[model samples]
Target chain A: MLGEVEVEVYAEVKPTESEVKVKRAVLNIIELDELEVIDVNGVKYIHGKARGLSYLSRIRDLIRRERIRDTARDLLNHSVVGDEVVINVNKQAAYVGVLSFAMGEVESPLGPITIRIKSSNPQQLIMWLTSG
Target chain B: MLGEVEVEVYAEVKPTESEVKVKRAVLNIIELDELEVIDVNGVKYIHGKARGLSYLSRIRDLIRRERIRDTARDLLNHSVVGDEVVINVNKQAAYVGVLSFAMGEVESPLGPITIRIKSSNPQQLIMWLTSG
Candidate 1:
């Protein structure tokens, strides 16, 4: 009789470091990269990393399009609003803005500084803002 | 000659479900559990999962204590300001909030709702706010 041989197969991956440090807060984004478009089942979006601190990980991806339409139906006439948020950029001081909407940007300084609606870094922002 | 034997190893681990639906934002925190305290290397901090959409993976860990002291010395008397930001929670409507400081909590609804300094949910906050 022949002896059976066993082997382990490992997937090819480098465990991307999607992390960032805005001011003093650290964020981590697992399995992300610069401009990597991804789709989870039927959802589509992109991945990104936080810079600066090595403890913060975050992600920015587009929601499933179907969900948008569903939300519209479930809450028709629902007027979307914005949240008051503040940001500080590389010693440039902090500026106040409103996160009216969201757009997944695989880049940092996320979308040319000032945006009309929505923003990233809320968890990070609140963490920093609340931490005395 | 003596025969040799080998054994396989396994661990007690299940992929964590750290996701959120901030408007339409998505974030993933690998290997995280609600209110699970963690310590990697010499760093110690808490872990949290986002609420909203799934596609964003962001982290909010306090920088090493020594780093904070270093930054203070590096930029003495540097006035820390705020960034113009916005937010919308449930049906409470949108309200602009500045993430001036950060305090990690293993719980969501992140604190009593409103805060003074620091906040969480940037990548998520941004993803939803921008996805028009």
Candidate 2:
């Protein structure tokens, strides 16, 4: 019942098939810690080990406002990498490739993560929401 | 715990200092359809809403195989991009970016998933693991 949430009700629109493929790749290629995505009554979630409002909530807001998903698909299709590139793709999937404003050199992972979720898996989603 | 699963434990050696930044950037930048990451004793995971053990599991195996996190940080640090190039930095971080074996693209909030975790958020991780 994501819709039932009394909050402002912020949710990004669903993504397309191709976009899914690219994101899956990004996670595969990079991300160290794996996050869990659980959906209940339509509300999706990324399980984390930290406290506070989870860092991703901040990222998600930016994604929705900037429409980064669609932009990513465009970059994927055309293969564009620049400081500020405006990707033009069909069907406006809404995405953004943020130029990290942070600093410091990062190393790699101690080992790969055990699990990763990039989209909604029907069975797991059902299990996650219903089990709880 | 994850080690016992046996399957090559393809887990990336684990991420360090700054690379998490760039990879997190990539996630915020262009991916759609949120993924879940569940860590059991330390195996991070990304949960998908699809079937067949989830698509992101494929991505994780890749993350470990390649050292994209180190590369992402270097990119985030020096901001480099090309058809093919080298990402040299302080230490040896493992990461690789596959241009894309398929066409089209994407990852996001169905309605801004109620739960989103980027790193080890702590409590939730405990809840997730203990509950299971």
**Top candidate by DockQ:** 2
Docking class of 2: incorrect
Q: Worst ten-residue run, lDDT, model 1 chain B? A: B8-17
lDDT by residue (A1-132, candidate 2, tens digit) is: 121111011111122112232333223322325444546575333223332222234433443445554553333333222311112121111123331211111211111112222212223322222221
Instruction: Report the C-alpha lDDT of model 1 over B17-73, residue by residue, as the tens digit.
Output: 111221111112112224333455633223343332321222112112223433422
| Deviation (Å) of B98 in candidate 1 | 19
RMSD of each: 25.6, 22.8
TM-score of each: 0.15, 0.16
Error of 1 at B96 (Å): 21
What Cα-based lDDT does every candidate model obtain? Answer: 0.22, 0.26
